[model samples]
Target: MSRSRPGNGHRGLDRVVSRRRLLTGGAAATAALAVSGGVLGADLLSGASRPASRRLVESQPAAETAAPRQRTVPTPAPTSAPTPDPRYPDGPFVPGPDTRLWGVFEPGAPSNIAALAGVERAVGNPQAIHWYQSWSGPGSELDPVRLNNVREYGALPMISWEPAHAGWGTDQPPYALARLAAGDHDDYARSWARGIRDHGGPVVIRFAHEMNHGHFAWAAGVNGNTPEQYVAAWRHVRQIFLDEGAQNASFSWSPNIAYDGTTPFDQLYPGDEHVDWIGLSGFNGGSDLPWGGWLEFGPMFLPSYEVLVGYGKPMMITEVACTENGGDKAAWIRRAFTDALPNVMPRFQVVCWFNENVLVDWRVQSSPSSADAFVETAGTWRQRTP
Candidate 1:
């Protein structure tokens, strides 16, 4: 998503993609467009591309060139933007933990993928790689063999999902995703089915995550949906997908972890039957935070993760980022992911990072060199490549 500046909210996926995660609602998977303003009021949280950095976005225009150079000095930590434009004005969306210094908005080419391998080596594991997006049809597909190859590297396809970009979740907020949730709902689900079938495996599907908050129209609170109404809506959408038979998919009930206040994970819920997993997303900023506050400070993001223990199902940091800019930037990231170790392990299934530049660039703390280490330790990580 390209930066939209102040008053340019009329665009859609066709124009540019602005991937954003809020301090409260958080962001989305590869190439996802996040809406801030308490969900429906998305305009408050994110928009299209604002600008780019020389080293991160500009250096690796394609995935092949992915890799960041470590600085002798920390380089004052980057001043990250929540949403930065895609390098190619018009290209497919691809996200991954490769050579791109700042974020995945930049496509990962062969070189970029190679850089990711280096990171995997550093982390000491390379079983599977996220393979980026799981929703988009063709290029988004991942075959069994490809899956195996990714795993050979140690990471797995920690695929992610969104309600569908048809209406409200587009470039601007307060639009109409109602139609997407209702009429086109099954169609939306079916598309995913085809992709998974094509990929040939059981996949992870996080549906209308953070529904309690209001950025996208698919959720209950947004688009004028009441809790009960939204529940019904979710049931409808989920049922349609089940009917379409995306059997290879597992459902995850993800929500923004909470930054400003403790997000009432249970209240915004659509109920047990409608969900099989739980997750959190939050980036309430702190100077003490990493990645320019796109990621929250302290173990600020941890409480929400701890609360999911009662859910019984596996948990995931569906989207995570930190903005702290002191100490070893890469080491800080390693600590962020590693420290969360199993506070979260039993309840955990996967963890992914939002690659879009937050109020600034995507990679605030991670250098291509640093990323190599992080990628190795994680079971699965995803990226969006265009």
Candidate 2:
């Protein structure tokens, strides 16, 4: 998802006023602290206690010097076994025997099912193929041709259902969460659900993904969309799918890695009953833009992973990539597969790369080294088999 300057253009008059008050007051400070604790709790948990030397220094008076110079004593390592990774208390959520690989191919190019074949050719065969479609557009309807194509390739189809017109970067989006919650778009949602039911195969539906980002009109705090309205809208759509007997439709609730502290993601959650998978969008921009920096996978995602693991739902990195700029993209990709995914984030059931060249050169083949790194790293990880 694209980033934009924060605004309340889609908010109600009352909401805008309240938000302004919060921004100007102590409530904002409190919320910021709470967000910090939630996201960075894992790292904080380990180093929560101050060092003994610091504690001793603070306890001593400033006027009085220490009677004797305290000798530095090295602490011995623990003889006990190391604690297990808390991210998976009940063991990792392995859908099959291995992690699922998926992607959105050439997002800036034309929306064509045929383009996916090229993506598979570039990267190896993915366990799932992700594609996007707006509620109303040239490719609005759930195309059977696309679904079948993905199925024939022995991969599940993951659809990102944009609840607006196909026009990107438009100031005014056609659909709003408030209207959707009011049952205005029930027919459209139902029709799409019915199409999936008729397809007679499993489909992962990621609706209004990255809703925490203000760039999207459907995002909460935008377009008159409060957190409650977003949940209502989500349940409304999910219930319609259930009514249409789209039992094969697996719902994923995705939020961008909460780098922007505006939206509280916990409030936007529609509950475990409404969602099957918890999805996150974690990308490394690699110093291309002002917000961009050479961030490793752990720092970029570990905090968000800490928060999402508490949901107790299977997690998927629905969108992730590192730009080939100002750093070794190959090494970054290698670390993602070897260190982050397999070790730090073993609980994540699937990890999908955002294979697009939209904002930065995010494509795996942006450089020959990056391509080789991806292919080599991916080969070491076990992929889901159909």
Candidate 3:
């Protein structure tokens, strides 16, 4: 989905093409080499890399440092492994063999159930409900009400947790990646960790998503942030959650599909030890915007997918949609769920549809044909339950 910047007339993937060059041919190959820290690259990874001596806090046997924020009663460990639910033998939120989970993100969903239900009726029951949360905002306190609503509706709560200001602008100094790693936001991070621990259920925290895209403050080289700082910030935050015993919250590291100029995966990834799932966000803007190129689902994501799948972690297309300008949107939807999602990319366990009107009419209900196409193949995708 295009991350719509409200005040500025800019939206992700829809930004002016000249500024964010979408390279091809030899240029695309060079960029791919740069992503892997090839000789052509300036030492972007040098000095910024995580020290070889620092161990993940969870890997240690016990808490090795004092709590940086207020503490709560420690979360108790489970006495026994859960008797796996029939619908989800692997575990809650874990997709079954040959099964792919479907998720949706309506504009007012998880709070406005009536609006969310409208989408659910058009598509089948979604296995996950995707939404956003900012570190500093009026509605940011890990609201139990919102979480409960999604839980009651029988869908997993997938929160795209941004560390920036609530407005999600491109430059926010207070929420800088450096400050986050320096223990500046421990109080806030810890509170949410404790809240999830108390909630006693599964929640997917998509922290600092699409870090390769320069649309947000958290992206590398934006707002004075660097890939090294991003890695540190992620590991630091995940460590705090572990210290608080927030085992129920799973962390997903998402990046925008690797456009030519975006930051590389190796530079931003915290490591396999720090992440539970790998996620990629991509949108086909078609010919509706300046940078929108008409590419099929496979081409739009294949560059990044080739790299992320190598990480050997469960993968998800956290945000995806198509615009109706240059192609048959209905056929795209049909081909995606029917063939591309299942056959072309089997490692991707979750596919979340961006059902909003941002930039262009990206919603499946944008047209009768588009809506019908999605409904026809919706039931074929599989999901899990607690």
Candidate 4:
């Protein structure tokens, strides 16, 4: 049965909408994960609906309009202020230099805990487990069981919380950035804020990430969204979380690599006070698609890194992956983990891998050589502490 809208007490009906895999093969059908009050977390993992398949989308570099800014480096920690959370002594979810961390995004996670076994087998347990949730009703419902499962697994939970429903690209209606800013979704927002606040554990909420890119509804210049609306919507939702006392939930305002045709990061940023971490979604398509060519990890992310670093906050690579079609994936992984992350981008406290076979096989284990490269680098990482 269809349910009432938020504020009417009944959450919307749990239903799957029709859509295809984005960015590849025209469009393939996929189901969003469904949650209900009666289901156990394990059952949700194993029995809940899963996407039938996924596609690959590469970050194509374009002619940047403006000159690149000078890159910024990490500075000394602040001397005194609010008592820091032990999990993130420096800032909200910010790992210290001695505690560099990496995370993974398997297609099946939060629900299907076993889906991470392959990753664990290759590189040991990740410091964080990444997942997604849409603003749609059932499949996107915030459940404590899901959060606890990740915590119990000895990893922090990072949620890519999109404001639009699954498969709904740039034209989400009630979820328009302005509508959100105007407080049309307060009931739903309040519910999630309270849920995470009450759970009382460290959680990373990457809200409407890659807003500088046009793939999603929240992105400016698409779906009638303006940069102002985007910032307003972000600040509005963040304030609601604060009002609910959701101190444990930290907001990561992520944007795409400021490639050609992407919006400027400055225009879209909600400001330092509104954001906890500066995040970026970058990938090396590596000749996987018709328009893609192999680009090294350094060049692929350096432009955006320089821009985001100036924000003076801890940074994270919210989404990153490389396809093995054209260049050496193993070599890329070794350089990224060993040289680039440790030496070049010391301000980046966390790196999350997009480990799925979506458009092209992006899994680190796509080849034996690539898997081994990751294992070697991963072992050297100093896992973050509480």
TM-scores, one per candidate: 0.55, 0.72, 0.77, 0.76
- For TM-score, the strongest prediction is 3
Candidate 3 lDDT over 104-216, as tens digits, reads 88777777666766675666566677887777756667888777777556566788888876555778988899999999999999999998777655678899987876877
| Model 3, residue pairs in steric clash | none
| lDDT tens digits, residue span 1-386, model 4 | 11123211121212101011111111111111111011112211221232211100111222234665675976656777555332221112433335456788876675777888898787667767787777885566787777777755656678878787665556887789999999998899999999887765567898887776576788898889999999899999998988887766778887766655667777887776788777766667666554336778877677667656665576778777778988899999999877777677767777888787655787888888999998887556433221
> What does the lDDT read for residue 161 in candidate 1?
48
Q: Give each model's whole-structure lDDT.
A: 0.40, 0.60, 0.66, 0.65
Off by over 4 Å in 2: 2-94, 97-99, 107-114, 168-174, 383-386
lDDT of 3: 0.66
Ranking by TM-score: 3, 4, 2, 1
Instruction: Name the best candidate (by lDDT).
Output: 3
User: Candidate 2 residues 235-267, lDDT tens each?
Assistant: 899889878877667778887776645577778
lDDT of 4 at 289: 54
What stretches of model 1 exceed 4 Å from their correct place? Answer: 1-155, 164-182, 260-263, 284-298, 324-331, 343-346, 356-365, 368-386
Kindly give the stretch of ten consecutive residues in candidate 4 with the minimal lDDT sum.
27-36
Q: Give the residue spans of candidate 3 off by over 4 A.
A: 1-92, 383-386
